[model samples]
Target: MDKLHAQRAPGRPKQNEQNIPLQEIILRQAAFLFMENGYEPVTLQQIAKICKVTKASIYYYFENKAELFTASVVFMIQLAHQSTLRYLEEKDDLRTRLEQIAKAKMMHAHVDMETMLREANPHLSEEQFGRIRKAEIDIHISLAKHFQFAMDQGSLRSGDAMFLAHAFSALVMLGSRKHVIEHNTPQEDLPQTVVDLFWDGIATQPQHRK
Candidate 1:
């Protein structure tokens, strides 16, 4: 048996034996399962099986399925936020940066909120829901700050930064929908198209002749 396995006790596992990479593996697998098959259908056992660990090992890190699910979602949100930050850091104009952000979001947009909420087991409490909402707000604030910077640089039209951030986020989310993406929008062209649509608007530009 492994040293970590040998260190396990009857009731609880040894905390010191736990490793970060292993924990992250469990979280990733759990998050994938939760997104692929709704939360209600995924079990600790399933996560453990996918991670090649025991159910007790999973419980050593999480108290129950709800806790595990919450942790997985939090992990994914943090990753998405980090990716967005990286996209914003790229040396590009506001339109290019926004397109990069949209592409990043699209890559990580497998989770569906309505379906996840409906299938969530043990039903998330108000407090749990609040935590998720706060994570989202943090992302919003980060994006809003980026938008404010772009506006200051005169790259984007001046408007309420917060509202523009939310609108931009909504547009990115819209791109994630299967129906919207299935209409032969080439993968490479989709982000640019989204940016152009937002920047130029549906109405004809004054510079363009009929």
Candidate 2:
């Protein structure tokens, strides 16, 4: 990664006073900037400035802008997957757990992942894209396992767990969208509203017979 191109400057120390690796700092900053602005508009210099490091520091870890972009995105996805697992495990009841997960997701403004990936597609190579896809699939599989467990406990209807997981995630994403909420809709109520809608669909119910 260090061999691609060296700009006209004396190299800076790759570690800060706190002993944090320059590569980790660069990835965190780059992830935020790329998610906020998309791949095309974000520049290595911009990330360097935000990270309080020289552009050469970033080049030390990443060969080029495309490589940096890919690494940062994958890092962000892995962090998100870790966070979702923590949230999922916080509550025992499925409804409460889903609400907690939704609220955690809604706590921040989010760029749509699909839209972001589409914007980044032209710059990323196949292997870089594959890494990101695998990270995304990991999160979905984690959620699907929880859904399958709820089904086994008879809390949810017997259906495709993976599909239910995807459906719940989609509903949360839709609820989290800025335009979906009205001025009067309290932010605190949104998670419950989303979970209620989802629960009303696949939750197990008493069978009715004439």
Candidate 3:
């Protein structure tokens, strides 16, 4: 049978492979608008105007606001996964591994999340919010497994997985604070200090527990 004559999968559109470029362009612009302005305030008509397409064209890809928001979140997660996986695979030592994880997470969070969250907060329904919360939790849980692996490899001290996961994530999210002239700390020095504290200690090495 001819490929075109073959039945399409149920509920799935016969998407053109090359058209993905256009889809991504539209989604990227839409995601940015949503992140900056928010889903509740932005309509498909607005997105179309920004993307320079008619409302009819926007409807060809996404059905509604909810679907578009969900797709944007999924896209962000996918990009994060790709970046983390690539960096994590390259590091050799456990300390290096942890450092890479922290740096990668921090870089991504700083560059990406604030706007994403600002928009997502009001636009999402209760169920959507809960689901997103769980998805983020699961991402942390998966990261925790890597920390546990480091411990098993005798790189990090043995400890609670969930606690460590939450701790590491929080540290990255909170970042580090330091004074400039008063403290003489350079801007570049702060993140390295964060990495050191996770492995070393706030106090001297002699006083710290393994």
Tens-place lDDT per residue, model 1, 89-168, is: 88887678888888776665565655686667347877777776777788889989988888898877799999987777
Model 1, stretches more than 4 Å misplaced?
Answer: 1-20, 179-186, 206-210
| Candidate 1 vs candidate 3, lDDT winner | 1
TM-score of each: 0.81, 0.84, 0.68
lDDT of 3 by residue, 25-105 (tens): 677777667655655677888887877766656656666677777676666556666665665567576567667766665
Stretches of candidate 2 exceeding 4 Å from the true structure = 1-12, 179-186, 202-210
- lDDT of the structure predicted as candidate 1: 0.76
In candidate 1, position 88 carries an lDDT of: 82
In order, candidate lDDTs are: 0.76, 0.81, 0.63
Ranking by TM-score: 2, 1, 3
**Candidate with maximal TM-score:** 2
